[model samples]
Target: MIDSTISSFPLIGLVLLLGLAIGSFLNVVIHRIPRGESVVRPGSRCPACGHRVRPGDNIPVIGYLRLRGRCRDCGAAISRRYPLVEMLTGIIFVAIAIKSGLTIDAALEAIFASAMIALIFTDAREQLLPDVITCPLLLFTLLAAAWRGGWGEPVAYPFDLSLVFATESETGFPAMRAAIVGGLLIAAAVPSFWLIDRLDIFLFNKYHDWQTETDSTRQLTAEEETAIASYEHQDRRMKRLAMAIAIVSSLLWVTLALRLGNHDPLAWKGAWSGLTGAVTGALVGALPLWWLRTGYYLVRGVEGLGLGDVKLMAGIGAFLGWQGALCILLISSIAGSLVGLWMMRTSTARLATAIPFGCFLGSAALAMLLKQIIWLAA
Candidate 1:
C-alpha cells in the first residue's frame, strides 16, 4: 500500500503553501470588501499608477519586499499594511492548519480570522465596520460549524480533539452545539460588559448621556450649527431607515441558510444562537453610542442604532446562531473597553469618549466562534 504517512506530509505542505498564497489575495479583499466592491472582477491594480499587477508582481510578502513596499509602475510608496496583512494571514492560516489539519472548518476558520482583521483595522482607520465581511463571517461560521464532518472512524477519547476528529464522522449536532455554545457565550458577554459600563457611568454621572462625557467627537462649532438647520427633521427618519437594513439582512440570511441546510426548527437552535449573540452584542455596543449620536443631533439626524451595525448584527446572529455569537460579543466588548481606556488615558484628558464598540463586537464574535472549535472535544 502507498505510505499514508509519507503522502500526508506532501498534502499538509501543499495546504500550508496554498494558505499563504490565499492570504495574499485576502489582503485585497480586506481593503475592498468594506467598500461594497466585488472581490473578483476588477483584478489587482496599483492605487497610485492604475497599472495592473502581473502574476509575478503579486507574490505575497516577497512581492512587497522586492518592490520596496511601493508600486513599481508609479514608484509610489505603499503602506506597510500590505506586507503585514499577508504575514498575519499566513501565520493564522498555518496556526489553524496545525490546530485542525485540512478540514473544511479549518479553512473556514482561517477565512473568518482574515475577515476580522480586515474589519477591525478598516474600522480603526475609518469609523466603520462594514456588514460585508461581518455578515459573511457569521453565516459561514454557523454553516461551517453545522455542516461539518471528519476524517475517520477511529477512537473517541476524553478531552482529545484528535480522537474526536477521527470518531466524529457524523455532522449536525456536535457542530450545532459548538456554534450554539459559542454564540451564547458572545451574547452573555456583551451585555455583561455593557452592564458594567452602565454601572460605572451611572455611578459617575447618572443623568448625563453615557458616551458624551467620554466621547471624543468634537462639539459643534458656530459654523456647524448653521449647517445643521439644512439637515432638519431627518435624523429620526434616518434611524427608522436604518431599521430596514437590519430587518432585510436578517431575513435574507435566515432564509438563505434554511434553504441550504434544509433543517427543521429544532435543528436551527444552534445556528440561531450565533444570530442571537450578534443582535445582543450590537445592541449592547451601539445603545450607548446611539444615545451619544442622538444627543449630538439634539433630536435630529440621530439614531438609536446605527442601521449598519444593527443589520450587521442580524447577519452575525444568522451565522453564529445564538450562544457562540454571544461569546464573540462579550470578548470583543472587554477588549474594546480596555483599549479605549488606554487610548483615552494616554492620548487625552477628555471627560467622555466615543469608543468604537463595533471593533470589539466583531473581534469578540470571532473569538467566541474559535473557542467553540477548541472546546468541541469537551
Candidate 2:
C-alpha cells in the first residue's frame, strides 16, 4: 500500500503540470474573450509590438522568469498576471487532486476552480464577465449536478407540494414532483431574459453598451478602429452563442423532466433530485439580483448590476445549489462593501465609483468551494 501511494506522487505531479498549462490557456481566455478576439486562432504575441512569442518563451512561469518579465522583441514589460494565474491554477489543481484522489469529482471541481479563477481576474482587470465563460459554465454545472447525484446540499422547498402530486406508488411522488418542480422553475426563468432586455430598453431607451468608452472625442487610429469593429463582431457572436446555449439547456431540462415523470422514479431518483436542486438554485441565485437590478434602475435611473453578474450567480447556483449560492452572495456583498468603503476613504473617487462586484463574487465562490471540499475531506 505504501509503495502504491508513493507511485501516485508522479500522477499528482503530472496533474499539477497539466493545471499550469490550462492556466496559461485561461490567461488567453481572460484577455481575448473580453476583447472579442479568438483565443484559438492567434498564437501568443507581445501586446505592445505584435511579435509572436517564441516557443522557448511560452513556458508558463519559467518562461516569464526567463524573459525577465519583458517581451523579447520590444522589451515591453509583461504583466505579472501570467505567472500569477499559472501558479494559482497549479496550486488549486494539486490541492484538489490530493483531496479527491483523481476521481470524477476532482475533475469537475478543477473545472469549476479554473472558471472561477478566470472570472475573478477578468472581472478585476476589465470589469466585465463575458458570457462566453458563464453560459457554458451554467450548462456544465447543471450536467455535473445530474452526474454527481447532487451538489451535496439538497434543496429544501418551503412548502410540501408533494402531497398534491402524490400517486399510488410510494416512489412515484418524489420523481414526479421533482420533475414538475424543475420544469416549472426552468419555464419561469426562460422569460426572464426577454423581460430584462425589455426593461433595459424601457428604462434606458437603449441596450446597455458594455463597450462604451469615455474617450468619445479622441480620434481613432486605423488599427484601433479595426480592433473595435472586431470586438463588436465578436461580442455579437458571443451573445448569439449564449442565447443558443440558454435555449438548448432549458429545453433539455424540460424534456428530461417530462420523460422522468413517466418512468420509474426510483431508477432516476438521483438525477431528478439533482435536476430539481439545480433549477431551484439557478432561480434563487438569479431572481433576487434581477429584482435588485430592476428596482435600482427604477429608483436611481441607472443600472446597479450588470446582467453578467446575474448569469454568473446562476452558474454558481447550478454547481453549489441555492444554499451555497446565497452564501456566496452574502459573502461577496460584504467584501465588496468593505472594499468600497476603503476605496472611498483612500481615493478621490466618490460613491459612484464602479467596483468590480463579479470579482468579489468569483472570489467568494472559490473560497466556498474550497471550504466545502475541505469539510468533506475531513
Candidate 3:
C-alpha cells in the first residue's frame, strides 16, 4: 500500500530538493521575465565566460558554494540573490508539505506564493511588474481560498462573515464590498487624469509635454523627430520598450480575466471574490494619487495606476475573492505608500514618478492571506 505520507524522511528530503531546484529556475525567471526575455531558450551560462552552466554546476545552493560564486571560465562573480531564492523555496516547500500533508490546495498555494515572491523580487529590482504573475495569482487564489474555507466565520458554504468581523455598523459583506467600490473608484480615476492631460496638451500646445516639456516636445516635425531620437539616445527607446511590455501584458491579462469573470463557476453564483479583491487592490493602490489629484490635477504623475498594478489587482481579484482582496488592499496601501515616500525622499526618484504599486500589493496580499489562514486554524 502506497501510504501517502510526505513527512517521511525520504519524501521530505525529496520535497526540499525539488523545491530548491525549482527555486533556482525561478531565479532565472525573476532576472529575465521583466525584460520580456526567455528563461528557457538559452540554458544557464556564466555571465563572464558565456559558458553554458554544466549540470554539476547547477545544483541550487550547493552548486553556488562549489563554484565559490564565480564562473569556471571567466572567474566572474555571481549574485547572492540566486542562493537566497533557492533556500527560500526549499524552506517554504517543506513548510507547505507539513501544512497541507500533500493536499491539492497546499500544492497550489505553495506554488502561487513562490510565483509572487519571484514577481516581487523582480519588480523591486528593475521596477518591472508584470500582469502575467498577477492574473494567474487572482484566479488560482480565489478557488484555493474558497476550497480551503479560509473565509472569516464561515456560515454558508460559499462564504459569510458579516457577523464575526462586524463593526457597530459595517458588516463583513460591506468590508468585502468596500474592496469593490474602491476598485471601481480607481479605474474611474486614472482615465480621468489621462483625459485631462490630453485636454491640456490640446488646449495649449505650449504645454507640449504637459508635465515637463523637453527638447523632443519642441521638435514637432518628422525631420526634427529623427534628429531628436538620435540626440535623445536611450531614454526614449527604453520608455518605448517599457510601454510595449506593459501594453502586451495588460491586454493578455484583461482578456483572460474577462473570460473567467464570465464563465468561472463561482462568478456565476455569488460575488466574484477574486475580481473584487483585485479591484480592491486597484483602488487602494490608486487612492493616494486620486486624492492628490483632486486638488492639484497632477497627482498620479504620467503613469496612472501603473499598468503593472492594474493587471496585478485584477489578477488578485481573480484569485483571492473580494474579502481577502480587501485585506490585501489595506495592507498594500499602508506598506506601498510608506515605501514610495521613503524611496522618493532617499533615492533619486523624482516627485510624481510612477512606481510598481502592484508589486507591493500583490506581495502584502499574499502574505496576509497566508497569515489569516494560519491564525484562524490556530
193-282 in candidate 1: lDDT tens per residue?
Answer: 335336534643443332232343878666545433332223333333443443454455444444544454334433433333334434
lDDT of 2 by residue, 123-196 (tens): 88887887667766776776666656533333343322233444446565364456556555444443445566
Better of 2 and 3 by lDDT: 2
Error of 2 at 127 (Å): 1.0
Error of 1 at 44 (Å): 1.6
lDDT for predicted candidate 3 compared with the true structure: 0.55
- Per-residue error for 22 in candidate 2, Å, reads 0.8
Report the alpha-carbon TM-score of model 1 versus the true structure: 0.55
Candidate closest to the true structure, highest lDDT: 2
Instruction: For model 3, state the Cα shift of residue 39 in Å.
Output: 2.5
Looking at model 3, residue 254 earns an lDDT score of 44
RMSD for each of the candidates: 11.0, 4.3, 9.9
Between candidates 1 and 3, the one scoring higher on TM-score is 3
Worst 10 residues of 2 by lDDT: 152-161
Candidate 3's clash total is: 15
Assess the local accuracy of residue 162 in candidate 1 as a C-alpha lDDT between 0 and 100: 21
Evaluate model 1: give its lDDT.
0.51
Instruction: Give one digit per residue, the lDDT tens place, for model 3 in 72-115.
Output: 87888999989998997887777667655666655776777687
Model 1 lDDT, residue 320, Cα: 48
